[model samples]
Structure formats: C-alpha cells, structure tokens
Target: MTDPLVLGPLLRHVGETTASVWVQTGGTATVTVRSGERSWSARTFVVEGFHFALVLVDGLTAGESYEYIVEIDGAQVWPPAECEYPAPRITTLVKDRPTRLAFGSCRTSVPHDAEHHGSHGVDALRTYAMALADGEVEWPDAIAFLGDQVYADETSEEMREFIGTRRSLDEPPGEELKDFTEYAHLYALAWSEPANRWLLSTLPSSMIFDDHDIRDDWNTSWTWHEEINETQWWHERLVGGLTAYWVYQHIGNLDHDALAADEIWSLLAAGAGDSEVDLTAPLRDLVERNDRHPEVYRWSYTLELGDCRLVVLDSRAARVLEPEARHMLDPAELEWLAEQLTGDVDHLFVGTSLPFLLPPGLHDLEAINEVLAAGRFGGLPAKGAERVRQIIDLEHWAAFQSGFQEVFELVMEVARGTKGDPPATVTFLSGDVHNSYVAEVIDAEQHGAGSRIVQAVCSPIRNPMPKGLRVAMSGFSRSLVRPMRWVASRSRRIPDPAYPWRVTHGPWFDNNLAVVEVRGDGLHLSWYAGEVVDDDHDHPRLREVSTVDV
Candidate 1:
C-alpha cells in the first residue's frame, strides 16, 4: 500500500450543515476530504509516532446527501480501486425528521470463522452495515457504542500475536495491552474489519469507554485503584489507554464549537495552521493529569439529533472510588450531568456504559454490597465483600447509592418540569451488561412528571452469554420482582429509590444491537441480530429479535 491513510475516514459529528471526518495515517501528510467541488484539508498531528487528522467539512446543504472521498496530499486514498461498496456518503441530519438511534456494546475482535462463531457468534453491527449498504434498512442518524469497543484485558489471537512480538509472552500483563503502541494496534484490529470499517466511514458515531476498554473492573473502587496503581505495567497501560482512546474515539465526539473548546485540540492547533504538530508529550501529560485528577478533562459529550438530546456520560474513567465518598461520577461530573438532564427537548437520551436500572434483586444486592465492602458488617466481611464485588462485577449505578440517588433527583427535577418543559420520554441508553433489557419507572412518586422514564440496555454486539448464564439471567429477571423490594426496604443505608421500576420488555440474551426511533406519539425500540442462515458465515441475514413501543 502506497497510501498514507492508515485507519479511518470515520464520519464523526454531523449537523445540518457541518461534518467532521477523522483519519489515521501511516505518515505525516495533509488529509483532505472532498464532496463535489468543495474540499477541506488538515495537516497531520503526531502522537507517539502515529499520525492523524480531523478534517471538518462545512457549508453543506442541510438534509442533503453528499458522496465524499478521502485524499492524502491531494491524491484520493479512500474508496480504494478494488473496493466493492459505493463511496462513503456524508448524509447530514434533516431538521424536524424523527431521529433513528442505534446503540450496543461489549463486542470482541476476532476472526470471523466457524471456530470463533461457535463462541462469539456473528457481529450484529457488521450485519447491520451490510444491510444498510444494500439499502435493506433505513440509515440511522447515529450510533452510540456504549462501551468495550476494544478489550484491553482480554486479547484476541491477533492481539496476542502482536503482543508476543513486543514483549515477553511469559511476562506480567502477558497478552494484555502494555502501552500506547499496543493500544493503537488493538483499535486498528477492532475497526479494520471490512464491512464494519465501511459502515463506520459513513455512519456518524459516538462512543464512551467502559472497564474492558482499559481493563475489567476498571476504577471499580478505591481499593482496586490502589492495587492497580502499585503495579509496574499499570501506569503505562492507563496513560496509553486514555491516549489511544482520545486519538481514536474521543475527538470525533465533539462538533465544531466543542472541538474548538477542547484543551488538547487547542494545543495541537495552537499556532501551526498548515505545519505538522507533534502532540506526544502533551498527550502523556494529559493522560497523567486526567488519571490523577479525573476532572481535568471531561470524557462526557452531548449531541443534538433533531428533537432529541443525547448526553453520553463517562461512567468509567471519571469516578469517585473512595468508600467514604464513592459515586459513579465525581462532583464536577455529577453537576454537569444535572445540568444536562434539563428538558425542552422532545426526547432526552442519556447514554451510560453501565445500565442505570439493573434487575431489582441484583440492584439491591449491589446496594448492600457497597455498604458491606465499606466495613458495614465487619472488617473481615468487608474484605470478603470487596473480593466478591470484583468477582461478579458488582459495580453499577446501584453500587454507588449516593450518586445514583442524586442523579435520580436531578432527573426527577427535569421530569417534574423544574429544569424546563418535561420531555415526552427520558430514556437511558446503555450497554456493558452483555444482555438486552428494558425497564420503566412505574407507579411511584411522579411528582407531577408525565414523562416516561425508561432504561433500554443492549449489549455484546458479537459476544453471547453461555446457555447456563442465559437461564440464570432469565430467571433472575422474573423471580427478583417481589422479594427485592423487601430486600431494599430493610437496608437503612440504602434509601428507597425515588422512582420504583420493573423490567418491562425483555432480559433477552443474544448477540444483538438495538434501535430507538423518536416518533410522534412515543419512542419505538427494537433489537436485532445477525443470523447465519444455512451456515453461511459470509452472508449473515439481519433478523429482528424483539420490538417494544415506549
């Protein structure tokens, strides 16, 4: 390959008249994106020997479709001569149109073969891409990948092969990512799949990281943090993970104004308009500062899609883990969330990596576990509780009762019309739970809010739960109903939820992706999966698994 373009021409933020394109290149070169006679160009920025650019395409007609091509140093690099699909199109959002949002999480990178399919199953996202490319389904306004886009702790055979070349196979951390270079390779492997790559190039997508993006149970608690901080490889891993995430995922999340306001963007674009900017040193400082003080930079982002307002929160990196003051979000982050929870929009969607409303019994169990881990029962029991917390992944909104309650209070305020006119529906879109389910705040303290507060969680776009866990989760969803109320009521440390909820639609265990369409009456939600018919792995068919109207 003589092209400098390495990874992406990913369509990031797109508005009525503006769009941003992100690309990773193999060398220092000017990246240009052209639509018809109009072209936009940006010089490459270097981060640890890696070159990238985010070029903004503007002044386009609203609600119009424009086929775009990528050029490196004025030579077309995208839509390679051998490409089978059409040239990627930048379709800007149409004002007043109902928004179609697709979301999922927890996908693993692996070769698509019979052996891997026996475990991981078909990639629903890729199948969706194929369908979209073939005009079988309507295009979504955007897709928000909740988390685990790449697993840092769980390496694939390809990742392990790369890791083996870099470090000793028998060493500590082993196949797990060690630094920025490894993390870079991991992202490349994750997004390089052909159908998925073409889908991403054309679809405006936003993302947030969950624990597996760095490591499982990342920032789960203060004790967990203290232990990881003591490790030799962790510091580099932390910095590298954040650095790669910023370069790969975070920058594309912001629009024109938000990108201009970003500190890192400002530094890279400071005085060098046309010259190449090397941000390796600044990136290291950024990751170090952000890890030491989580509030230094905000990973959370907000976007507007027609009548919908989407606020994607950063539930993993920015957290208060200390037992005395544990929260899913820190003080500043909580305040920001409160502000963003305002109404005035027809639909408000909060995208969290972890589900805000889990199964009632499991939620109460987590609530009690948080207290027990903090030495509520005894010192010895606290140790046991801490170990159990990590074992079953007991960290979620319920695990941090204070943050959970406070955020709910803010949500209630918006629902009650305090912040602004209450939205028709307040939906929390999430992944990372490995299963798909829908829950609704029902028959509790409404406090004058007529809005439908719901939680729609879909996950593991490629990975599937074992039959054993599927059975356990199915029974867990139904059986936890009545007793969990009593279980939660008994704990004085755990106050009753401001709004009681129940699982309304499903606890479906499938390798699936879900979509939410903002309609006139209410919201329509559906989950779909890729079914390999007749054992045809190369041409999986997209099938709808379930549908629910909110």
Candidate 2:
C-alpha cells in the first residue's frame, strides 16, 4: 500500500481564476483538484530530496467551494475513502464581507489529557477548526499560522522517540534536528492531525515561520548564527531545515504571480523534467546566505482582501545584524513594508510572528535587553555578552532595535492616520510568545477605536508555557519590568522611550485559541482554551475578552 499523500495551505486567487494545493509525501503522488467542474494536476517537484506537489486548479469563482483528491500507486488518497468531506472543502477568495479566519501558532503534540500522554496528541486546534469548518461551527475566510508551527529545538517525546529509533541521540547534534529526514518527520508530526489535515485541504492559509520552526533561537544575532555554523552538522541542519521550510511552508503562501516571479520557483519548474535534479545544494546555499546577509531577497509580502490589506512581515530571516545598524527588518524589507502600509485601505492587518507590543512591563524588559545587547551593561564582559545574546534570542521585536523602531514608527503613522487617506483600522495579528492576549491602541480619547489601531495575539494552540516560566513572566510583567524601564531610561546611558502600552484589554492567562471579527463599526475579538471533557475536548469556545469602538 502506498503512503497517503497530504495537502496544505489551500488557497485561491489569480483573477478568481486559479487555485493551488501544496502536497508532501513518502514518494511521488498524483493530485486531482476540482473547482466546480474544472480539474487540474500539478507537476511534481523535489526539495531536500523530499517529493511534493503544487496543484493549481483554474476557473474557480470567488467565494465558492470545490473538492479535490490524491492518488498514489493507483490508489485514491486524502479525506480517505471512508472520511467525510468538510463543508467548504475548497473556497474561492472573497472580499470584505465579514471573513471568519482562524489563526494561531506554537503547537506541540503533547497529550490533551492530564496524564502527560506520551503519544503526540491529535492536533486539537486543527481538529476543532476542521469540524467547525465542516459543520460543527462556522468556517473562516482564511487560516493564518503566525509562527513556530513546528518546533525544531523542542521536540515532543514522540518526536524524540521517532528520531531515536532512526538515529543515535547521543551524537553531537543530540536531540536537535540535523538534516532533511529529521525535518521531514518534524513536518509529519505537525501536519498529521486528521482534522488539521482536513482543514488544510480546504481553508486557504497564510503561514510565516518562527524560531522553533528551525531551532530555539535560530537567528537572534550574528553570534548565534556563527555559533551554530561552527558546529560540525550545523550547516547541513540549517540548510536542510530552511530549504524544506521554503519548499513546504513559505511557497504555498504565494499566488501565481508571486510564484511565477520567484527564482526558486523557476528552478523547480525547470527541474520537473524526467532526470532528477538536486534542489538541495542550491537551496541550502540560498538559506545560509539569507541568514548571513538578509538584504539579498524579500521574504515579506502584502495580501489584498478587497478593501483590506494584509502585510505579512518576515521578522526572522531578514535581519540587518551589523553592530551599528542592527534591525529586525533589513533596510530593503523595511522600505517595502513602509510602502505597503502607506497604501490607502479600509483595514490594514499586519501579520508578524512576534507581537509588536508586549505587556507594558515586558516591553520595558525588552528595552533593558537592548542596553544589555549593546554591551552597555557591565562593560559587555564575555560572559555577559553571551547572556545578553541569549536574552535577545528569547524575546523579539527588541533584538533588532533599529528595525523594530522603524516598523513601530511606521505603524504609529497608520494608527494616527498620518496619511491623507489613512486606513480605518490598523490591526496586528501575531503569535510566538507561548501565551496569548489582546492589546488595543488607545486613541487620545481612550475609546477602543473601531477602525483605530488594534492588536490581537493568540498562541500555542497545543504548546503550553511551563508553569514556572509563566509565573516568572507574570511577576516580571507586574513588578520589576516597568521600574527597570524607568530607571534605565532615566540614567540616560541607554535611553529609550518607555512603552505606552496600557492593557485596556487583557493579560489573559492560558494556552489559548482566539478569533477576531471585523464588522462595520467595531472589532470583535475573543479567546478560548482547550478543555478535555469526557476524554475529548469542548474548549474551542469563544469567550469575549474585550471590544474596541472607534
């Protein structure tokens, strides 16, 4: 029997004309996608020695549905013969008509039960979202996974076991992923949830990777990259992981035009011929160079939804790490980002893997990190410098101060309606910090501006922060964090403005899921946590956290 083929990042566009489906598997497979009566097949491609497919179906109507399937070794696969088709199995992209999108990231397949279940739990979020999309609940316009969709550093017990079964964990890379095979299995764990798989078959998704997708702190600084590259297997590991990430996750996010213009895309298209081509070598070189010199390419892009615009920023992989001009977004990427947000739109949504604003106290700690990172504290001793780098690796938006400041100022312009025809609302949807919360930009009048700038964060649909770290974060946020920001700035040694963040919305506690609805005059955002009831879960409930009025 042939291994089942899996598809993901279902999306539609290109003149309300074409649809694309990304597939990965143990071997080559044939995918058949149908929109209404039209059907299509994608030529197979390989990256990092893994076989995958991208099928594009043409003649789709906007806001409509379609069905698709896969066949390997002359056997039909996907939504297995016995499985039921979810509602809206395939949908054409639509405009600003109350789009219900489900988005979150940072998932680890631990036991949903309290027994610390050893087996990787079925993806609860994926399951719920699928069932909801199927019939249990309503479907969303799109699904956006902000970051850490796969954990390269923190593998689950099951993943560890799988790795151990395949190779020795006592080696230098020990328990850390080091090649294409390891990365492949990591993806299997990530996408194996049936509901999530089903959801992927239908819901158009936009994904951007975070650190855990590669390692704990993949690229916080030049030093981190240097250390990792110095390791015997680090080069292979980074190259393989990033190449697979690009082939698997990143490419699916684009439409036909973007894909057509991509250099790698052209290579893959050309390589679709009979004799096999090794995409890994060149792909590896590209990823490695991207890490070392982020300005060479553009990983960030913009998505237009009728009157609304979604600007997905590449917080990682596009950093300017020179000591003098450290930044989260390289100059080129920042320039592009600024230009995108400057465009006139009704609603502007910025998708970043890292939250732009943390709790006020934590925001202050980030400033301290800047000083420490600058070697301003304790004379930047060897030990202290390593420690500071680690801190920068841990939280983001501060690691690249110049880039962070530039993005901040740009968004602030949109929030204040600095442009002649400003976006009615500037909403940022992000994930990465294991916990989730919502922050609204308070207007001078203090009413949650309806279309006023707002931020909604949802994280770890499966992953949970350790209780100790959670406690530390809470205590630090409430007590020492704010004071330190004040004292540090007042001392004038490394003065940075204190965060004007007022938690008028929440500091909600939980490994939760969230949803945001954009109606005419208001924005409705809510969160839910997983609760196992009767051996299953019913915790995907939406509890209103807060509302903002313009």
Could you say which candidate leads in TM-score? 1
**Which runs of model 2 end up more than 4 angstroms from their true locations?**
4-15, 71-75, 84-88, 111-114, 117-124, 130-134, 271-278, 377-382, 388-394, 416-420, 444-451, 475-482, 493-499, 537-550
Error of 2 at 69 (Å): 3.2
TM accuracy, model 1: 0.98
As for model 2, its CA RMSD to the true structure in angstroms is 3.4
For model 1, what is the alpha-carbon lDDT of residue 97? 91
What's each prediction's TM-score?
A: 0.98, 0.89
TM-score of 2: 0.89
Regions of candidate 1 where Cα sits further than 4 Å from its true position: 444-446
Q: Report the Cα lDDT for candidate 1.
A: 0.89
On residues 1-550, what C-alpha lDDT tens digit does candidate 2 reach at each position? 6455644434433224466777775665555654445667665666766777777666677766666655544455665767655533666666746645567878875544445422332344754664476465566667778888888887777788988987899986888887888888888777766666666666777788888888887677666767777889877777877887887788777778888888777786776665445576777778878867787667777766655778888888887665566678777887888788763776788999998876666666665666665666565453465575576454478555566667767876665566536666787889887667666554522432224666678877766666667766665446665676676566564547422554555555555556666676456665655444455442333233333343
